[model samples]
Target: MSGRKAELVEQVARIRDLDLRLLDRVSREALTLDRNWMVEYARWQSGNWQTMSLYNDSGDPSDVAIRDCEARETTVLEHMPATRELLRSFGLKYMWVRIARLPANTFLWEHSDYRDLADLERHRLHIPLHTNRSATLTLGGARVHLGYGSLWRLVPTNRHGACNLSGPDRLHIIMDCYADDTFRDLTSNLTLDDNDIQWLPEATDGEISAHLDEAVALGKLGYHQAAEHSLLKLFYQYSMPEGMGYDLVIRAYEMMGEHARAEQWRLEKKVKLCLA
Candidate 1:
């Protein structure tokens, strides 16, 4: 498991399939509306959480960016084809989207997505629309420096923060994705939302299994780093005495030029502990 764990670390550095240009094409125009809505929502609610969220960002200089969820109505999320594709590939469900406007020389305080304390797949995703080479996000112990035309996502699963050292006002988009029951029973949760959407929680094997499947898919898609990171965050539930659960980690190791380490994990026995 330790060797596998080492492999997992390397996997996270190599994933780059998320097309920033494609996302930029959609978000450049779409950002105005989303930013406006967030501003308006912040003004009206002040402290109250809005749709698919817990609170609106006030663009406050003193405020550090955070994720928010709605009051009640939507507890579980339904998915569209495109969103489902992301969920299947990432092994998490989308709920609310968040954006933060950070001033220069500012950074968010470090924090982790508390297991079971938050919801399932409970983490944050960030994308920069406008920022210079100085914008960066520090995840786990590694600081991922962001440049134009890059896509990066991380679980609040570990402690993380952001730094805006550049001159431009850092514009970042955050989408919250959760893990839930029905979502876990199958590969992808394809139902569309007729009303409100709920974030899923990771409580049962169904949810955990779905996440593992998603991790595998992500690894296969060459988002090896993202997949391995997901697996590591889910360490408590996914790890079994059988141990081959770290197959993605092995792949990640090989990708990072750790063939010997990868071979070590490959020699371990594979085990899946079904909690029933």
Candidate 2:
């Protein structure tokens, strides 16, 4: 990592933990509201996952689409006084804010956001309201178990995903804020120690083969999209070389006798990775 990038990682890792009681309060407040969860299918996410917007540029509660960072207005904050107060305490310029929920035994496929031209320079912060040991955020080959009552800065530029494996519903209040002097001040003193990092193990050949087999079976059942998603998910499940998951997708398409489609994915992979 470059010096600046390494500094950011350390700063984010050193973010001060929030109070547990405040997190519990926010959780209770969130639970009291009627659920208005929506999924971003275009992102190729899977399982029972959804998000509720609390703040956005439109100030429309129903608008949960993640968009370019901008000055935002509160949507559901009137109903979530505690949450509003909590955010106000930070005194940072906020952009989009939302509560994301991932039910038990669900997985969010690996993906990156804020990579497009429309995306503005900003940082994503997370406050875990409800989570268990099994809920993990995987990024840069490290699996992070962010405990409750703690604030974490997610690296939006990196390939990352989340999973709630055999756990209760996992919920997080995510806030997008523009980087500014105040942001720098808040993170300047924070430093992530070595113990804070946990590296993921490389997948065994048997494990990779078994997953590919499952993907193939899904394709045979005529669920081509599911099969593709299954193959794409391997990027998160294993410590494979860059673009290996994309290569597997092409292979899966070929296995299904879709030569044309395989070639299409081969090109798409390049575009997706900006290699084209």
Candidate 3:
């Protein structure tokens, strides 16, 4: 098995314990839902809009998507720190949650964590949360039952999809992991240096993946201009001009509460050559 794969299993086990603890502090009624993000994003694509009601089919042994829960409405990503901290008992960090509802006959489209990070790895952990009894969880092409207090891991990079068969509401609380001191020591303090230019994954559906790959290369080569240009070319509709939006990136990183890392990138500019 790959080192990343092993890391995933270990993290998942730790998170499961945390999940059990979280159920005690949380109430099935406490889970809240909102759709601001969904409506706004969907409106950008098309003017049609719908306010979705949050449902709780998670209690059902068998759940269905459309008939049980309406997915078109925006789902909220609530910050549950106590639940997040519980994962730390086993040494985990970085957490987020999304309460997903799939009415009967509804299917979650294929997706992965790859789009979430520029520095994605296959070893991260995922904790599936289903508080509803009728809710049935499926992953990696299989059906797995997770009771009210049960939690499970999902490696998104692998070919995976999900379905809810219980005619009720369900919530999927997923979290990701990174290598801690143990992993760093095992890797002998390895690092990922930059490159001059990296080609996009040809089959990436002209997605952000290619541009991100190029951006990393440009940053490594200290070619901020070219990198920004490529990003502009790829994300043409973005607010700032291409190859000149490091400030925007800095702001976003700041919003995500990653000031140190953002500052580190700014320091990378120190080595860059400036024109007279």
Candidate 4:
């Protein structure tokens, strides 16, 4: 296995069957708040997905930009007393805390987080408040249905995506915490077992052809970026040959008569995936 794959396997861990009563309460309170939940990170995301920041740098609920982390609470946190107490009980330094909601038929495109940072001293954790069987997280070529009442540590540096094919709004309390001795001790007993890993089947040639046809149709409809995102999402959804997604994106641009853009995506694929 590559170093990156090994890191992902080692970093992602789950502590199942935690008491999530506080998180449930917080999710209800979050729905009542009129705070803005728009996410600005990726334009490809559907509007059905929303995010509410509880803890951030300036304590501004509208500010969703990821920056130097802080522990200040936004206005949304005022009504979440139980959540506050629960987080404090961890006895670890906190950074950013947010609630992400994904309604039925919504999906987050495949992407990695915190790549711009030089030092990765913080770890991202997820506590599922509400989810369904159809809601799934695809990471490191494995599809996982994270059950409710569990704490999961996600490897933010790895490529990952999420989808809620059918749901009553999948909600999760996501936290970024400083990795300290306390955090290490908390996860000391947790081990990555075979049961925790569920590999997605490889995409058949027919499926790949159908995806390409859909991409072509999307481009004809002038949704070029969405078309490209769809192709890139295949990389996370199924096991494919290296650089296949990038090549498809380049082809999509070429078909649109955008040679410069096509070449740009080709080079981007090389740099991002470290393809020689």
Using all chains and alpha carbons, the TM-scores for the candidates as numbered come to: 0.40, 0.84, 0.38, 0.82
Model 4, 102-162: lDDT tens digits are 8897877555677565475888888887888778777766767777767888876666668
Q: TM-score: which is higher, 1 or 3?
A: 1
Model 4 stretches with alpha carbons more than 4 Å out? 1-11, 44-48, 191-198, 221-226, 241-243, 261-276
Tens-digit per-residue lDDT, 193-235, candidate 1: 1111111223466765576677667766777656655654443
Tell me, by TM-score, which candidate is best: 2
Per-residue lDDT of model 3, residues 9-126, tens digit only: 3322222234455665543423443332122222111122222222222422112121212122112212435443444444432322233444443334222334433554424433
**Candidate 1, lDDT over the whole model:** 0.43
Candidate 3 regions off by >4 Å? 1-15, 18-22, 33-91, 95-99, 122-129, 132-141, 181-276
**Residue 56 shift from truth in candidate 1, angstroms:** 10
> Hey, what RMSD does candidate 2 come out at?
3.4
Predictions in order: lDDT: 0.43, 0.73, 0.36, 0.73
What C-alpha lDDT, on a 0 to 100 scale, does residue 93 get in candidate 3? Answer: 29
Query: What is the model-wide C-alpha lDDT for candidate 3?
Result: 0.36
> If the candidates were sorted by their TM-score against the true structure, best first, what order would they fall in?
2, 4, 1, 3
Against the true structure, candidate 2 has what lDDT?
0.73
Q: Which should have the higher lDDT, number 1 or number 2?
A: 2
What TM-score quantifies how close candidate 3 is to the native fold? 0.38
